[model samples]
Target: MIKFAFLIALVAVAVPSPAAAQGASGFSVVNQTGLNMTNLTIRRFGTQGWKALGNAPSPGGRGSVQFSDPDCAFDIQATLEGVGTVVWNGVNLCEVKTVILNRNASGAIWVDYE
Candidate 1:
């Protein structure tokens, strides 16, 4: 019986669990230039307005900005970082800008765009 229990435990440990859903959505921005940016702001869907993510004084700096909701999803309007704001949905909790994720959503989390 003890051996069987041990075997079951081993099997459970070996199996991988499903990925956790985003608790709070956000973006991580890295300054990759020689100039400093001011009044950096980030906004998500269902929010009143843009929330200040962070500010960088110089290039090669990194910052993180979080959304109000863990499950909150948003459409990026006027990103101002890239060429233009692109529509995105189903962002995850605590996810930041540096990491690119698929906006298309399914059940609880956003999946990678195909």
Candidate 2:
């Protein structure tokens, strides 16, 4: 009967907690600029702190980054060579706007804040 008890304990411990069931969200970015760009960096702002989710060279000329936070409360920052943009998920920000890209060129980055 000891083996049966041990199996029951193991199964209980193996279950995932509610808090640990969080997942990442996927987002996309499009470069509307006629010129091709490179060196794309993505950032996610959280209660803990801001962190870089991922970075890659824009193969599509346009850049795309996914936010990997299930409970995302993040802004996005995209940097290409010497230009960058900061985006939030809201209409009204303290000083920064959500859809504003620092670069004068044309391009759009899509973000899904879960």
Candidate 3:
């Protein structure tokens, strides 16, 4: 019985959970750039028009935007109120659960991965 229990525990440890195995639902848009995002849009890479997400900063100054994405892959376009447009192309929504929006050292808007 002890050996069986040990085997079960080992199997459980070896297997990844549903959430871990599959992709997470609705990837999060993390804002670390300290700028309020006035607009957010997403669509397939290489597409023309974009679908608007909304006009709201993450939550706090350093919070993130959590939105639903059904596809495993997608793209993002974020517009800062006073800043310029920052675009990320061909983002794998499933694999990359969160897309970080921040400014680079040169003071230009850039995208970061986790």
Candidate 4:
């Protein structure tokens, strides 16, 4: 009985969950700026409404957002505390695993994808 139970547990651990199988459709965000990201939203390119991804990954933290659209292009919006709102247009989530928020030397916000 003990060996049977251990086999079942090992099998369960080896099998991927549904969400993990679908991870190709989703992406992660890495916040590298000094300010806290208060709000994060995403929308399909050329769409009118924004879908909230989630709340603050405080400075230097990271978060993940799952999207359901079959389209690969999207626009991302972020609200940084004390810094107002910033948007990155026409990002291809299908090609990237992580979107990194960064600040340039000129004090402008920029993005990097990995």
Ranking of candidates on lDDT, top first? 4, 3, 1, 2
Q: Which candidate is the best by TM-score?
A: 4
Spell out the clash pairs found in candidate 4: none
- Residue pairs clashing in model 3 are none
Better of 2 and 3 by lDDT: 3
Tell me how many clashing residue pairs each candidate has.
12, 3, 0, 0
**What lDDT score is found at residue 27 in candidate 1?**
53
- The lDDT for every candidate, in the order shown, is 0.46, 0.43, 0.66, 0.78
- TM-score on alpha carbons, each prediction: 0.38, 0.35, 0.57, 0.70
Ranked by TM-score, the better of candidates 1 and 2 is: 1
Q: Which one wins by lDDT: 1 or 4?
A: 4
Residue 23, model 1: Cα distance from true site in angstroms:
4.1
Top-lDDT candidate index = 4
Q: Candidate 3 on 9-106: residue-level lDDT in tens?
A: 99999997776556435555677667667667877667787888655455334334466544555677877656678776777767665567676546
